[model samples]
Target: MNSPDVSALEITSSQACRVALRGPELIIEAANKAFVRSAGRDGFLGLPGWEAFPELRGQGYLELLDQVYRTKKPFVGLKMPILFQPSKGAPMEEHVTDFIYRPIEDGSGHVTGVFIESYDRTEWARA
Candidate 1:
């Protein structure tokens, strides 16, 4: 058996890396460009509110989110199916699978927020 490259930086998928605050002030400070796009929204610098992403309700994301929030550890989505809310008049919603969550922190090393990355598996699958 062969091992994989441990030090490889691959952009094989559309990734999302986000960092924000937790608690009553749950503010989504920064989300990578890919997340902004996959989320089908912009200006994610502030608390966009979970309600905005109606698709996430009742999904396993809540559990993963909780872990990230509490532990400030990285969460990952291995071939995770995702649905993006479409804009008004849009024919259908956009879908993506596979993403990663990398936690961010302040200089003091407190549990800050997480960096979200979405990988468009379709691209690689079709290749």
Candidate 2:
């Protein structure tokens, strides 16, 4: 496996609160610091989204992502509920977030991947 570019990850980390890139086959190609903070672990690069976060499978997110990928359309979720283990070997916690899954296209306009940009809204939802 190739190493993730530290400088690129650092740049992405600085640009967004939660950012990730999912390449073909839904493998996670990149993730930012905030994403790691939310996931409670790192090393997700090259894993399928569902495999990386098994808790999301039955929660409709997997299907949603598949739909977005197959249709090559963007999806926006407001206050989407996600369950994630804060730490490896820790209990899972539910978080509310606003997210967008935008289709990334290549030069020929074919969708090559999905770019995820998100903001945690758990606190706001509890208010």
Candidate 3:
């Protein structure tokens, strides 16, 4: 599926939004560096399916995506809990500082992909 180029986005999206684009099948089309770091994935580009994000699975993220795609509307989520896999032990959960899911629009005004924004809620890595 054809999607917008990452380079087409403004510099603000790169710095502030932690934006990324997913294709028709939710394949990661492109991701800014912030997104890579936040997800703790090094090579995030080209990953397929929404399932690629373990924290997002069955956690209302998919449902949110579906709602955005169907309505072609932008959504913002604040202080939501984002479950993360810990390095030393079992999975850990933290409140997401903030996030946004915006539907990408095609020339025909149809939803083609989505733009993501995420913020890590941990403080100073004290854990």
- Local error of candidate 2 at residue 103 (angstroms): 0.4
The TM-score between candidate 2 and the true structure equals 0.84
By TM-score, the candidates rank as: 2, 3, 1
The lDDT values for all models are 0.54, 0.74, 0.64
Regions of model 3 farther than 4 Å from truth:
1-13, 86-90, 124-127
Those runs of model 1 whose alpha carbons end farther than 4 Å from true positions after fitting are 1-25, 89-94, 123-127
Candidate 3 per-residue C-alpha lDDT over 1-127 given as tens digits, one digit per residue, 9 for 90 to 100: 3335345465235554355555566667776666655555555467763656665677787778778777777889877776765332446666455778888877676787787767765563335
Best by TM-score: 2
TM-score of each: 0.64, 0.84, 0.73
Model 1: per-residue Cα lDDT over 1-127, one tens digit each? 2212211133223344333434433466545555566556665456544644556666677567667767766777776655556553455554546766555555566655554555667556546
For candidate 1, the TM-score is 0.64
For candidate 1, list the clashing residue pairs, or say none: 14-118, 15-117, 15-118, 16-116, 16-117, 16-118, 17-116, 18-114, 18-115, 18-116
lDDT of 2: 0.74
In model 3, state the lDDT of residue 54. Answer: 63
lDDT, model 3: 0.64
